[model samples]
Target: MSEQRETRQRYNEEFKRQTVKYIQEQTKTVTEIGEELNIPAKTLHSWLAKYRQFEDEPIINTEKVWEQERIIKEQNQQIDDLKEELAILKKAVHIFSNSKK
Candidate 1:
């Protein structure tokens, strides 16, 4: 019989930070974010606790939040424009198909 050795998964600091930030900003429980991200809930909780110990600061910076919101707004506008274009194309296709028939 061969003995099997299991290697532990290692997460970088940035990943840990982002996971904690998601938990703080998304209004989702730590367990929910952990499950969604495929990370163990206990591990995430420990990471968050460690982060809090190091710095009592908020997870996301105010400027970063504003920038993220602006980017999301711009992306949403682009999506709306694309949807309108798609609708116009659908209308044109319908008109052309009827004319052919």
Candidate 2:
């Protein structure tokens, strides 16, 4: 039998701080952000708790906030497109049914 070793990941202080800041600014839960970023929720939670100690002088990255906004805008646009497509399909169905009647 062969034994395998798992390697642990290391994150820098700036990355940790930015992640904590993201969690604070975004509406997403810690688990959701962790899944998106491929980080563990527990790690993110710990970073957030550590940063909370200096809540009076929190780090705010404008570029990250803008990036998040762009992503949200794109998602909203995709949702709108899906809704329009659904409406068109429903109308087509209604027309087909009426024609068959």
Candidate 3:
């Protein structure tokens, strides 16, 4: 019987930092990026944790990510409000036009 051992791949600090930055960009989900880069989600999460732990590192700003999420939420709420207003106006117009006929 033959026994085989698996070898682990090592990544440098620079590569890890860049990967963390890429994740912060919010272009795609972690799962999608992991599949594309052939990296495990757990590894990517570990890199993110380390990146966030050191505040002095300027490679990626976690604040920016949170701010972007806030802005998106506000914009979506505004869109919903506008859509509701539009529907109400349309109904009012329909009712008024029918009364004249």
Candidate 4:
């Protein structure tokens, strides 16, 4: 039997930016805006933080890239070790086969 599938939705950054502008223009409190928009106040606050773009204004600091460079390096080291082990195993197999001659 085929099960029903659900689709999730997300708003683009520009949409959030415009919403912030609308909120500012209406001078709406966060709670009221949240209720009217059917969005959590905290989510609106996050949009306010990241999407604020104005001339001579500080850039938004909302989205920080969370790269795990250290984890990548560790994984590379593991791959190198596995390659070395495979090479050693191949050499051992070669030597034992020649010894039977």
Candidate 5:
């Protein structure tokens, strides 16, 4: 019915955290939680499965995360320097225009 289509819902981070935790602690069925939260049951299962895998094999790559962040920062710095140069070139164009007048 059009009434169902008109209904809108959005879940916050805290809501999702609580739901996931409840599913883990209570060992309640995903179908049950999903129905209560109005989210698809399969989505809850996927999140639960992912959380279990992450818990079993935690990421121990602090160095890799730092390296990736460093690379991104360097690229951003280079882009900023290029923009400054472009601004200087624009200023030179205006200078030439004034000289012509």
Candidate 6:
């Protein structure tokens, strides 16, 4: 008779940290993130628990994290808006220059 063994997938610390951060962001439920990431909801919940409990201290202040994320998102949006505006201006300049030819 042959012995059977079970194999489990392993995730790195960085991946676990990022997953916990994503969970803290509250953008999606654990079940949703689990489904999207192909990880079990129970596993994600466990990671959240372990990471959140580290040193019995809050990791980087949730308020500050959320605020920084919001600021970054806003800055990204502004950059995207400026890029779109520049493209439009370039197109207008090209059209006007062609008209003068």
In model 1, what lDDT does residue 52 have? 46
- The 10-residue segment with the lowest total lDDT in model 5: 49-58
Residue-by-residue lDDT tens digits, candidate 6, 5-88: 344668999999988877776678899999999999999989997886454345688898999999999999999999999999
Candidate 1: residue 1 lDDT (0-100): 19
Q: Is 1 or 6 the stronger prediction by lDDT?
A: 6
Q: What residue pairs are clashing in model 6? A: none
TM-score, prediction 1:
0.45
Error of 1 at 77 (Å): 36
Q: Which segments of candidate 1 are over 4 A away from where they belong?
A: 1-7, 53-101
Give the per-residue lDDT digits (tens) of candidate 5, residues 1-101. Answer: 88887784666667666667777666567798788878898878766665543443337699978998999999999999999999999999999999999
Candidate 5 lDDT for residue 29 = 75
In angstroms, the error of model 5 at 21 is: 17
Q: Write down the TM-score for model 5.
A: 0.40
Worst 10 residues of 3 by lDDT: 1-10
lDDT of 1 by residue, 1-101 (tens): 13323456788998787777667676788888888988889998898886644343455789989999999999999999999999999999999999999
lDDT of each: 0.81, 0.85, 0.84, 0.78, 0.77, 0.86
State each candidate's clash count: 0, 0, 0, 0, 0, 0
Tens digits of per-residue lDDT for model 4, 1-101: 13323433478978898888777666669889999988889888898788755643434454422235666788999999999999999999999999999
- From the highest lDDT down, the ranking of the candidates is 6, 2, 3, 1, 4, 5
TM-score of each: 0.45, 0.46, 0.46, 0.43, 0.40, 0.45
Off by over 4 Å in 4: 1-9, 54-101
In candidate 4, the residue pairs with backbone N, CA or C atoms under 3 Å apart (3 or more residues apart, or in different chains) clash, namely: none
Error of 3 at 45 (Å): 0.4
Candidate 2 residue pairs in clash (backbone atoms < 3 Å): none
Model 5: lDDT to the true structure = 0.77
Q: Which candidate is the best by lDDT?
A: 6
Q: Assess candidate 6 and give its lDDT.
A: 0.86
